[model samples]
Target: MRIVATNPDQTQAVGKKLAALLQPGDLILLAGDLGAGKTTFTKGLALGLGIKRNIKSPTFTLIREYKEGRLPLYHMDVYRLEDGGAEDLGLEEYFNGDGVSVVEWASFIPEELPAEYLEIRLNKDETDDNKRYIDFNAQGKHYEKLVAKLAE
Candidate 1:
């Protein structure tokens, strides 16, 4: 699905709707540039997941685990990862484990991703500062189910 978000809140709202469809062991690949409201969308997802703690970007820490929610949320930012560091950081464990993993700057660690996952791409529209074009692709049956759930 493709969505045009006029403001940060709209993007967050989309994230919140998507969050409701997630299940344990699901992987979300977030693709966007800096200041594309990726973190804001993540915060919304955390909120929908029933996470009450402050949600911060895991830029330096690489990953932030929030077990306070119904299902653990492993939020990761791999933007700072160097060659071979994405896998080295033990990201695969989170992807295969009993939690939902959302990876920001996911393009940097494409090789570590599974064949089936939800890829959310955020793009900036030069004509409108508040505008973002988000493209979502469901890669497998798992994601297809998510898309179906989101449509509800």
Candidate 2:
């Protein structure tokens, strides 16, 4: 599914909708350039998950855990990770944990990803400052259905 977000709020609204379909052990891969609103979308996802606390990008800390929500939210940012460094983080535990996992700059550690996941790519529009082109690529049957529902 592809969506055009006219502003940050719309992007976050899309994330909120997507979050409703998430389940434990689900993986979300986010790809986009700097200032592409990845964190904003995640904020909306957190809200959808029933998380009430402030949501911030885990750029420096690498991973932030929020367990107060309906399900735990393990948000990760691997932009600073060097090639092959993801192995040391034991990320598999989180990926398979009883929560949803969202990874920013997921392309940085493609080898560490599981076989099934939902990849969301955000691209900024050159013509509009707040506009973004969001693309959703679903892998595996569950994600396929999730995407289908979102497309509806």
Question: Which candidate achieves the best TM-score against the true structure?
Answer: 2
After superposition, the stretches of candidate 1 with alpha carbons farther than 4 Å from their true spots are none
- Model 1: per-residue Cα lDDT over 1-152, one tens digit each: 78899998898898888878788899998888898888888888988888999999999899999998878899999888746577577877898998889999887787888899998899989989899998888999879888877767
- The ten-residue window of minimal lDDT in model 2 covers 79-88
Query: Which number leads on lDDT?
Result: 2
Poorest 10 consecutive residues by lDDT, candidate 1: 81-90
Model 2 Cα displacement at 27 (Å)?
0.3
True-structure RMSD for candidate 2: 0.9
> In candidate 2, what are the lDDT values of residues 32-101, reduced to their tens digit?
9999989999998999999999999999999999999888999999999855689999999999999999
**Candidate 1 lDDT for residue 141:** 88
Q: Over all chains combined, what TM-score does candidate 1 have?
A: 0.93
lDDT of each: 0.87, 0.93
What is the model-wide C-alpha lDDT for candidate 1? Answer: 0.87
